[model samples]
Target: MEIIFLDQNKWIELAQVHSGRIKGGPIAQLFPRLVAAVREGRVLFPLSVANIMETAKRNDDVSRRLIAETQAMLSLGYVHRSRAARIEVELRAAIQRRFGIEPERMPTHWAIAPGFMQAFEPMDELMASPGELARVRRMTSLVDPAALYLNYMVTQDDTRRREANAKLSEGLSALVAQIEGRRARFASESLDMRRRIYAAQSWVDHLDVLNRIVAALGYSFDDLSALGDSTMRALLEDVPTMNVEVEMATRLEAKTGTLSANDVLDMQSFYTAIPYSDRVIAEKAAISHAQQAKLDSKYGVILSRSLEDLSGHYVS
Candidate 1:
């Protein structure tokens, strides 16, 4: 199946089409065929953490509900796993292969779990008898993605979502904040040099995660540390998400881009989607940054801003 990732804006447009708010535009023309593709399993549009969290910030209940329902239909409960989760898998695979050890296989469910999990770790199912548990599972195997989305997207009475969003936003800010603060120090550095410098720093920042996986493999972080600089550079490139993260981060810093929370979310979206999706429709600024970074060619994803780019999808 062709995996497609839509930015939250594109999703809103598609949602407008789905709601008949848009009747004769490029998105409207593309809608029916896209639905057919979904039913036939010829294509899929996966949700990302950015998409979910951004939608929750919307206060328009009607628009939020429409987008939620539209994404539910297209995504069918498939979201890219959390960035924390995905990089671990990537780190494990690369480390195991570097050591000539056969890699451990994780279930595909690890990559694709119920969307209600909201792109976090899989929640454990409640305890129950085997027969009854299986029966309930089968029934809710058709989980309500619409309801799942509405639960978070359409809340006015609760401080829980506001607190959750604040915490999640804060978690993403540290790396960007650290990198951005050092901008003046590196302003004179060449782009490639800066990218490499930041890449190494990014890896070091994430060493705690790598160390956990290293311990599990009966190895220590020093074994990974012992690799020559050239080999380490190659290993960094082998991990797609980090490569994009470093490249985009460097590009933004190069252009003296203003930092914002949305910038962090954009990074999250690109690092997850550009590496994994066949096509990515994101904000123009994002597509521009990725294109300038040459990420589109690197990942072989069609990075576009216009829904008309999808017009050719089902055409033969």
Candidate 2:
């Protein structure tokens, strides 16, 4: 099935429409068709952890309720499948081999929400289980350490304005708080270190994802190293997060860009979407960045700003 990665803004738009806050709006009219596409299995809207947390931050009950309703309608979009524990270890190792990431650093398992293992029955059965629901809730997060590190390096060389940098600082703060909380839990009387382990290991999985992208493009590390930075970025590698950063650098050098934290976060989300998603609906700026990076030509990801536009393009 074609995976549809909806941007947070589109979700909010849908929620606003579905909640009747934006009555008779053109965007609102598109919701039913989008839902039909999902229900028919013509497309899948997988809510990224980022998508969930952003939705959760809504202040109004109407919006939150709409989010819940939308999630339920899109339940079949959850794509994670459980493999044998031994197979998982082998997969991680194989991914490490292709990516050149150290085996020690690779996560032994995909990061799971608390008690996800206990809920690992068949997908259909697990979907109704409290454990599965909890796992989905736990997976909601916004921290992207790999992207943050690259942003830090890029900011150092570009013009770093405190106003423009504040968002980046806030994101970093959130990431730190998450890690500290995990550390505290792991150090306490509780011996359950799964959360701590998963948190650290997930980043390695992110790297492995980049490796797969590079391999699919038929580029070796040496080939990537020698390519123009602009060319290398088209692959959407997050640890290096070269695509958006390169754009940021160009804009900064040309005195045309003000790097905001939201831009960085959006870029991270877009990058994360490409590997698993067949299409990505995101903010116009993020889509433009990806287009400039040649994402469409390289990875065949359909990047669009409107859910309606994407639906019409793919579902007709």
List the global CA lDDT of all models. 0.77, 0.49
Q: For model 1, what is the C-alpha lDDT against the true structure?
A: 0.77
Per-residue accuracy of model 1 over 165-224 as CA lDDT, tens digit each: 677777767756865777878989999898988898988988788789889999887787
Worst 10 residues of 1 by lDDT: 120-129
Regions of model 1 farther than 4 Å from truth: 105-110, 121-142, 145-147, 150-157, 166-179
lDDT of 1 at 127: 25
- Worst lDDT run of 10 residues, candidate 2, spans 109-118
Q: How many clashes show up per model?
A: 0, 0
- After superposing all C-alphas onto the true structure, candidate 1 shows an RMSD in angstroms of 4.2
What is the alpha-carbon lDDT for the whole of candidate 2? 0.49
Q: After TM-score superposition, what is the CA distance of residue 93 in candidate 1 from its true location, in Å?
A: 0.9
> Clashing pairs in model 2?
none
Best by TM-score: 1
Error of 1 at 202 (Å): 0.9
Candidate 2 lDDT by residue in tens digits, 1-316: 5677777777777767777778875676677777787667676665554554454444455555576466545533242223222223333444444455565463322322222122233322223367755544444333232222223223333233344345546775675465445445544432224422442454354566545545665665575556555533323333322333333323222222344445445644664455446778888767776676576666677788876675344344
What TM-score, over all chains together, does every model reach? Answer: 0.85, 0.50
